[model samples]
Target: MTGYVLRRVGVSLVVLLGLSFIVFLMLHTISDSPGRAVLGPKATEDAINAFNAANGYDRPVIVQYLAFLGNLLTGNLGRSYILNEDVSTLLWENAGRSAMLSLSALVLALCIAVPLGIAQAIRKNSFLDRAATSVSYLLYATPSFLIALLLIALLSQAIPLFPAEASQSSSPWAVFTDTRSMALPVLTLTITNLVVFSQYQRSSALEELGQDYIKVARAKGMPERMVITKHLLRNACIPLITLIGLQIPILLAGNLIVESVFNYPGLGLLFLNSLNREDYPVLLAYTLLGGVLTVAGNLVADILVARADRRIELTK
Candidate 1:
């Protein structure tokens, strides 16, 4: 287990390194430069060159990349050229909001989806199953961003029940205290993710139902509830754990669209803003943070799966 963990951690470090390189490459490959963006269109060539030199953009790309990586190791993410704000400060502030929104949505989706999945598996081919399957297919096929827009229009604009923007609160706790403002964004994520989660979990349960252990449990006079809960549901939920981990990153990305639509001040929106301004420092920081999150999520999933299934070895 120790070796397995060490291996995974090594791979995760390599992944983050690769991701950092990609982000650095993207910063230069694009036609637009931070110097130009900061100096504005009317600025002369000399001013742009001066800005670039001052910011070390004049350095060899390899030197700059190494320096960037070193800075990251030392917890120095640099400053946003346009706003003159520390990238780390901005990331921490915005990341908290995004984490709150994403986690709330994830919890809400899991609560509804798991039970709905179990019900569908229990009553396979029945009216509830058919109806739910149809709806799940419909929802899972639809785009999350499109649904987010519609929710904003109907719930925020038409009914005026919730605030359109999700950035009303500074922190997660504050978000709940200002629950009305959070209603629309949370609902939008819950709806979209519930469809995805229910479909995946229902399939996992159905697969478990076909397994021989389920039949053996039932044949041994296990109560229907006990058989389903202990014999089937527990195993079925293992796959869902991995799916949950995978969805964390997806949810973070999805928040870009949702937050943008609602004018929320989360990391997604901040990333978008940085993209618009060609803020390489801020973008690089987010890329690293995202890579770390993905690595951490996959590691957590692996540990959970290992815990769930003792027969399975942790090593590759």
Candidate 2:
């Protein structure tokens, strides 16, 4: 397991390096003169040249990229030209809120999905199964922003049960203390994730039920509940371990739309603002962080799958 983990980490580093270069090239391509963009449209050509030279942007692209990698190794993400703030500081301040929101939605969706999906599988062809299927379909079809809007209209404006905006307080922990404001955005992401998770759960459970071990457990006079819970549930959930790992980045991406709708103060909102302003430092740093998370999530998933199923060999 240790060897496998070390190997994965090495591979992840390579992937992140490639990702960084690609994003760097794209951002540079998008903006012909980043210094000019940072300085505004009215800035004189001489001023732009001075600014670029002062910031080392006048250097070759490969040299700039090498310098960035060196700074990254030293934990010094560059200063944001537009915001005039440290990119690392901006990330630190906003990452927590996005992490908490994504985590809350994931946990809630998993809790609901496991039971609901199991029930659907157990009561297949019944009214409960059909109803759940219909609801999942509806949720899957709707965009997250539209769902956020619908939730705001019904729960925020029409009834006023929860606040329309999620970022009511400066502290990220406020999401926990101020459930009223936090509920809508969490629910928006949760509803979208639930549809995917529940469908996977139901399918996995149904497949497990058809396995020979499940029938053997039942034939051995095991209680129906035990047969399902002890023999089936573990195996059914194996697939979801990998699914959960894959969904982490997707949830964060969903935050881009969901946070925009709810005016939530998170990485998603910061990313959008930086993109609009052409803040290259922040954009590049964010892209790096995102690549790290994607690699880490998949690695964790592989570890979890090994633990969940003893038949799987970790060293392989």
Candidate 3:
């Protein structure tokens, strides 16, 4: 297991390096001049040149890439052009909030999805199952932004349960503690995630129920509860584990829309602000951090899947 973890870490690092290169190249290609973009085209030519020279942007692409990598390895993410703050510091401050929001949504999703999915599978073709299927499909087909808006309209506007704007909270803790302010965003994400997870769980559970072991367990007169919990659910969750791993990154990315709709002060909102301000340092930092997180999440999923099913080989 240790060796497998080490190998995964090494691979993640390599993948992150490649991702950084791609992000850098894409950023460079999209903008005519990094210095001009940062300092503005109205700046004097000498000022632009000076800024470029100071930032090492005037160097060859390879040299700049090497310098960027070196700085990244040393824990330096550079300064944000718009915020005039260290990019690392800004990320550190915002990442926790985003993590909190996403993690809460994930928990809510699992709480609602797993049991409902299992029940639906157990009662296949029944009205309850049909209802579950219809709801899941509806949520899966709906846009996240639309969901957020609908939630805001219903819960925040009409019902007046949750606050419409999440940004009014004084701090991260305040947002978490104040259900009225946090409920809409959390619900939006939970609903979105729940729809997908429940559908996957339902499909996996139905497949596992048809397996020979399930038949044998039933034949042996195992209680329905034991048959489903100890045998069926255990094996059925393998694919769901992988789905969870993949969902981490998607959930994080999707938070952008959720955060925007609710005016939440998280990385998603920060990312949007950075884009609008053309804050390259922040944008690049967020992009690279997201890539690293994605790779790490996949590695964790691989290990967990292997642990859950001994037949799965990590080295292979």
Candidate 4:
């Protein structure tokens, strides 16, 4: 396991390096002048040139890339030209909020999905199973933003159960203290993710039920609950583990839309602001961070799947 983890980490680092370069090249290619983008069109040519020289934008692209890479190795993500703050600091502050929201939703979805799916699978071909399938399909077909808006209208505006939007406080941990503000955003994500998770869970559970072990356990006079809890559930969750690993990064991206609808102060809101301001450094760093998360999530998933199912080879 240790060797496998180390190998995966090494490969992930290489993939991240390539990803960074591609983002860097694309950012540079699209923008004619980073200096003008940062400094504005009103700045004099001399001022822009001076700004470029200071930032090493005047150097060859490869040279600048090497410098960027070196800085990245040492934990410097460069300064946000428009915000006049370190990109790393900005990301550190915002990413925590985004992570908190995404993780909360994921945990809630899993909790609801597991039991709901199991029940549906157990009652297959019944009215309950058909009803659940219909609801899951409806939820899955609905767009996230529309869901958020509806929740805000019903729960926030009409019912007055939760705030329509998150509090505008700048503190990253404010949501923890003010849990009410987190309700709408978390619910939006949960509703969006629930359909996918439940469907997968139902499919996996159904597959496990058809296996010979389930029949054997039942034939041995095991209780129905014991057969499911002791033998079937863990095996059924094996496929779900991989899906969860893939979902982590996707949730981050999906939260962008949800966050915007709720005005939640997370990476999504920050990313939108950066795009509006043409903040190239922040954009580059954020894009690179997404790559890192993708690689890390998949690696974690692979490790989890190995741990969950001993029949699978760890070396793979």
Write one digit per residue (lDDT tens) for candidate 2, span 93-153: 9988998999999999999999999999999989999999999999899989899999999
User: Against the hidden true structure, what lDDT does model 3 obtain?
Assistant: 0.86
Model 4 C-alpha lDDT per residue in residues 280-314, reported as the tens digit of each score = 88988888878888888888888888777755654
Reference-based TM-score of each model: 0.95, 0.96, 0.96, 0.94
TM-score, ranked from best to worst: 2, 3, 1, 4
TM-score of 1: 0.95
Instruction: List the global CA lDDT of all models.
Output: 0.84, 0.89, 0.86, 0.88
**On lDDT, who's better, 3 or 4?**
4
Candidate 3 per-residue lDDT over residues 200-300, each given as its tens digit: 99999999888999999999999999998899888888888888888888887988999888888889999999988788888888888778878878988
What is the lDDT, from 0 to 100, of the residue 254 in candidate 2?
93
In TM-score terms, which candidate is top?
Answer: 2
Model 4 regions lying over 4 Å from their true place: 170-173
Displacement of residue 123 (Cα, Å) in model 3 is 1.1
Give the number of the best model, judged by lDDT: 2
- Segments in model 3 whose C-alpha atoms lie over 4 Å from true places: none
1 against 2, candidate with superior lDDT: 2
